[model samples]
Target: MVDFFYSNQLRYRISRHLLYWLSFNLFLAFIWGSTGESYQIHLTVQALLWPARIFVVYGTLYVLIPKFFLKRNLFVFGISYIIWLLLVTIFVQRTVWQYSRSFFFPDWKNYDMFNVTEIMGNVFDLNLAAVFPLVFVFVKFYNAEQKKYLTLEREQYKSELNQLRNQIHPHFLFNTLNNLYSLILKKSDEAEDALIRLSGLMRYMLYEANVPKVPLSKEIEYLRNYIDLEKLRLNASNTIHFTSSMNKDQEIAPFILMPFVENAFKHGISNDKVSTIEISIIANKDLLTMTVYNTKKINANQDNGEKTGVGLVNVQKRLELLYKDNYEMIRNETESHYKMELTLNLI
Candidate 1:
């Protein structure tokens, strides 16, 4: 209960409501006291009655009426408050007469003929006229304040997600560059070709990845470039089987598939003997499927000298955030083979 009331949001609204209610009653009390003796009320009675009247009528109207009805419906709201005022008038007059017979004695209970017309007139003329404008003033400012807070929260989340994505891409690029460095050290002619492929991959990352989504064809091209670069480092005796079937028009988030391909290259391909890597991608309508298989190298030493790094872990987080329950990934292992199959709903 304390958490609810003391929340940043509730505290602000409660503070504003109290100020508006008090200020409105103070102004109304001054005008009501300055009016004719027939309408005059004792200072002590006025103090008690005004607060009770505001709480009973406006409080009920604001709390109950708005619950079952739209807040913008001023007509229904006005009618509900008029009804509240009628009940309050009856109760106030009865209580006064019961307490003091001389209060309205000359004509007694029939002095002010209580009826629908008189109640509605009093509601509009006294209760609502005094409160509605003030309530609207508070409501307008409060809604604007809430909108501002929501906008700030949205921007903050966007910035944080972007920062995480930026960190992931650089981590991936650093690993790829280290692989290319190994090729250069061995005096391989493929270094130039690898550099060219790296340039194209970097262009996609720098340009297309700034947007939230990219054409599926573009991501596929990026995966192909990465595989081609990896191929340069392996010996001529190695075997790699790669196949892809895709929609030329579909789209997905940029850089989404690169980490999976990197994982396959890191774990599957062996540099020791006759080794093979098999990769395939099939995309149709709203569905995408990718499979990667490679033989585990004997005495396999992982790059970055770590069991696992940022790539696969980041992919898992990205999938959870982007696809939620819409994607499925399965990995299988055998004595001579390891494979991963993934299906994603691109729609």
Candidate 2:
């Protein structure tokens, strides 16, 4: 009952009433056909009879089939027809019996006067005439609504995923350029090496990163190149210590782990502080875990109010949508350090 109301079964109710009224009017016409005299009197009788007929027929349908019975289509149709048959039997018998009792109950000879089959045929004719058209209309409308809704939802999801993917490209390019600028300032011979690495990174971003997924080994190689470039920039100051370990034989979504590493190197290391950044990745047949930790300056600049960097915040949103309950991300910060650990259950 609650589901019916919440589903707003107004159309169903209207169909039921329409079917019942049509059936009742046909039955009333059939009854009146057997009597020709006093047409006005018979029409008045039909007007009164229709209300009771509708109440009994549609009321039984509403209660038994929708509210009480199993609600299967075959069961509802079969039982409703059986109920209508019984009601018609009683109506025909009472009408004939009343007429006989009035005149010659004791002397009646021919008892098989009325045709029962014709009456039952008329009842079925009325029911099918109303049911078929309404069933067609309802099914057509329902299917169209379902298709439109699914199409809209699919387009919305595609748009959102595209926006998120666009964000990754610019963020990555910005960080790589920053690292290149740092190398040029010190006139290091490794600046040539940095350019070579940057070209490889650009090739990967243009070709491989556009794919939905890439081998874990390829992504790890990308990260290693990025780390080496950063290393060349910090060689003069010697303030950044970076360590990395990974699985060389597994696969993962491309670029999934880069933002955390980028954030650590961006916020954790400085020109004046001796800082350490450690990254580790372990992958098995069913799971992958990546952890990154970086040391913070004792008197780090505190004016910026951003907790996780913008790149990491974007990564978090993507993780929530893509992995849902299949992943866990933990981020913690204290007066001395910042840490992030992400675990993904891969299919």
Candidate 3:
């Protein structure tokens, strides 16, 4: 209903204005006729007076308000308004009312042209008629300002999201390249296969993942490829467990889950000690849940804001921006392991 009134369509504007004027005229007729006067005569008089009332209302709304009042030219606006009110009251409203009364009651004495009381009454009536329509003018100004603010906010969000995503791209690539270089230095045959998988990952990042959302199946495939790349560099002491279940098709913000899995692999593995990394994903209807757990060397400073790299922090910010109240995340640490669990609503 609010949208209907504020709509910019010509037909809607015409209908809304017509309805307001009709209601205003009927109200005036009712008020005047209640004092034992003929209702039809009062209605006709109000109808004849519409031309002057419309001129006063529209001139104030479109010209006086915009040109002087909104510009803060208070002295000019006051002078112009008073002049407009007197002219309309004397030349237009008084002439219309006296002629209308004369037509209705030929026996009644006509009001004098310069009578002070009659001029003041016409001025009051004109101001009263303009009051309700003036409310609409302010309403339109407020709506325009609100729309402009929201547009700026949306643009800022897009720019920040893009910056965060760009930061992740180079960070992930640097880590993967380091792994690939290590394999090549060892004369490992796995280097060739890792390069191929890396090419596919880069393709997805550059193209498919650039959008706001991607199919859950495609994201899962990307994760699998990433895990395979990491597996090439893993030793016998490292153990990884990955599991997933999905009952229906879904779309999710791209790369939202990758940082957790990447963090697990980067910090979990140990050369001399047994290392274990576990990952799980489950999707049902509009909900998705993920868990990543990895064993890491215990340190006293881990809980004291020690640097844990950029991936986790970047992902946390992205989650807040994209999902806000629709997602929940929990982190836990113990003597030997770090775990993160995320629950997201796809809808």
Best by lDDT: 3
Question: Candidate 3 at 15: error in angstroms?
Answer: 7.5
Q: For candidate 3, lDDT tens digit of each residue in 1-347?
A: 87668887888888888998888877886788678887777667667767879888889977999999778687998799889888888776457756766777576575565778877878888888888887787677777778999999899889888988897888788879988999999999999999999999999999989899999988999998998888888889999999988998799989889989988887887776899999999999889999999998445235325344677888889898999999999999887888999999999
Compared with the true structure, what per-residue lDDT tens digits does model 2 show for residues 1-347?
A: 53332233777657655765676568667877877756666565455344435544555445544543434465665676567656654564456444644453444444443557745553564344335433543464466568889898778766765677677778778878887887788787778888999999999978987776777778888988988877765634344444444544665666778888888777777668667777887776668888888877555556234743666777777777667798998888887788888888866
**After best superposition, candidate 1 residue 130: deviation in angstroms?**
14
* Cand. 1 TM to true fold: 0.60
Candidate-wise lDDT, in order = 0.70, 0.67, 0.84
Error of model 2, residue 9, in angstroms = 29
**Candidate 1 off by > 4 Å:** 1-51, 55-101, 105-160, 299-309
RMSD of candidate 1 to the truth, in angstroms, is 11.5
Higher-TM-score candidate of 1 and 3: 3
Model 3 scores a C-alpha lDDT of 0.84
Winner on lDDT (1 vs 3)? 3
List residue ranges in candidate 3 displaced over 4 A.
1-23, 38-56, 67-124, 298-309
Clashing pairs in 3: none
Global CA lDDT of candidate 2, please?
Answer: 0.67
